[model samples]
Target: MDHDAISIDGGTAADRHARPGAAGAGGANDLLAHFSDPHSVARYAEGPPRFVPGFTDLHRMTRLLLTERAPDDARVLVLGAGGGLELKAFAEAEPHWTFDGVDPAAEMLGLAGRTLGPLAARVRLHQGYIDDAPEGPFDAATCLLTLHFLAPDERRRTAAEIRRRLKPGAPFVAAHSSFPQDDGERALWLSRYAAFAVASGADPDQARTARAAIDTRLNLLSPAHDEAILRDAGFSNVSLFYAAFTWRGWVAYA
Candidate 1:
């Protein structure tokens, strides 16, 4: 299956299979260490739904947007696909669709394999960052709940790489930590994010810790800046498709 992946050896594909400075898998040492733990990987499924508003809906909406322009037997590229929640959801929604999922967290990828079960046959789990992804003219792609892990520069490079791998006009759906960039507004929204998590039954202390990690460790940006990065990466007709409190999702065409 590795033979199916294209070898893009240009300057664009930086750091051979090395993890980026992303949050969960690629951010602070403590956080990345957390992700690498078998215990944390075992409990990964519980965190997103609690911290991210409408986690299930996010997957559904991603499938819908991707299928808007994707073929029935679409070959999709999924970045930061460590948990396999979205992969499982997408696979269940469209049996014919195949996926190439990339992430730096080996343990999380193992958990993804378990989460996928029999569905793993339809997906190739690449253990690396976006640049390590298959150089495909994929039917569609998604980078959900992952970009905030990367700094703005790395984020832009990653987006451009995803664009380059896509078929012309292919839809690329991305969702991450995008909120008001102002100092006061950022703090306010982060507080609300923590409140939402607590409201959703997250332990208050854990929620506070997660909120703090997001604020200090994740490289967040404004929705407008996020859109600009996509546009700068050569994506067209970018539009916001989901806005659940601190998170924002957008669908763009490559």
Candidate 2:
């Protein structure tokens, strides 16, 4: 995805892969390729609200947690920032806050711009992975519904990079597909994930298909390992704050 003059440095695929845990493969990984489609980008806004439990409350919770450490004039770094749902929510909540949003998919970032509308003025969109983001001592950071796409090693490396960009004691919130990896439990959680989607008004087959995709594609880990990833990345005071059918959220400090 190419960036215009106003956009941040969105490096090439090789540049993205130059470092461990680097995302934004210009050549297109499966997830990135999926979002690259105009159809997917157009429908992006619909998926999260319907698939993820308590989507609105999740954004509200993220804002509250960030506000605990971030100042009124906080400069936040948001990874997986495509579509701008969370960014819009945060901007609405804290009018003074400015943002640097990173995403691998240019189409989704464009959608984010459209979604933010006038609020887009406060956000600088970067169409690349974490590596494309500015070297910042940011006030806070967030990566939600995105990390599941990476392997454990990559996730740890990415979290470490996020921590490295934070000010001392800055809050970092991450939420994604996390559940038990135990044999029986893993299958159980996945079924529940699909069931919940259906209950939330999704087509039963569509929900089941989505669940199967997650089961095959996402690198899910047990909650213990998820917390350990934060700790291993040098975050302190890690605490789990949200847990839905197949999702988990944690707030940690750098």
Candidate 3:
């Protein structure tokens, strides 16, 4: 199946991580603390049916987006490259594509280093945010399941930073969790997500806990809100290519 052409139904998926914290500081501290554990990093790299909810398909969507939008020899910027899943996949898909994998966590970068294996040398792993990443007028970039951790201001900052790093007319693909505008829709969406967790292997209590964390911690935005943020950050011709309940994916020109 050309997963790229597959239309989303009601099914949804997300990149799972523990909440960052109050303001952005709390989240940064939480991330640093979370990446401190080797076991945690290992579990995260393993994907669903073992460690957390999302895995293969989410990364697959990212891959599909890049394949469709990025040039064959694209210089790609992978933001928040926890385990290098997208980096490895992209390198394998288009061997000529060089990558810069950026993440603030050393252990996660280390896991990414291991995941990249032979391609490790091809990818330049940076232990920082987009600002600390190597200078790049990259051909394309991806920030999947990473931005929802940022506060609104931080998200704008991130968007602007990414815009600064990419060449004009470059394609940037991103996926994030979103909330509904209507109270009824919001309740229904949350309930469906909680049920998806159970179906994806979480116990009911575990699902509830996960749902609570998402509701209380993650900085999910509505689709319109996301488009506004992108446009305000300087991306033009922004268009959403995929949607599955709370999870949304878009491609915008930098």
Winning candidate number (TM-score): 2
Candidate 1: how large is its RMSD?
A: 4.6
Q: Report, for all candidates in order, the number of backbone clashes.
A: 5, 0, 2
For candidate 3, the TM-score is 0.81
Give the winner by lDDT. Answer: 2
TM-score (C-alpha, index-matched) for candidate 1: 0.90
Report clash pairs, candidate 2: none
The Cα local distance difference test for each model comes to 0.84, 0.86, 0.71
Q: What TM-score would each prediction reach against the true structure? A: 0.90, 0.92, 0.81
Model 3 per-residue lDDT at 16 = 22
**Residue range 1-254, candidate 3, lDDT tens digits:** 12122111111111123323212546444545566477878777533332223555666666776667677788888887867777787787788898888776666777777777777657877766666666688888889777877777778788888988998888888887766857688768877778876776667896786677667666767888988899999999888877766677788888
Q: List where candidate 2 sits over 4 angstroms from the true fold.
A: 1-9, 12-28
lDDT per residue for candidate 2 within 146-248, as digits (tens), equals 9887777878988999999999999999999999999899999999988888888888988988888777766778999999999999999999999998999
Model 1 Cα lDDT, one tens digit per residue, 1-254: 12223211112223322343433334454565577778988899999999999999999999999989999999999998888899999999999999999877777777778788778889888867776688998999999988877777778888999999999999999999999979699999999999999999999999999989888877788999999999998899999999999999999999
**lDDT over C-alpha atoms for residue 103 of model 1:** 76
**Best-to-worst TM-score order:** 2, 1, 3
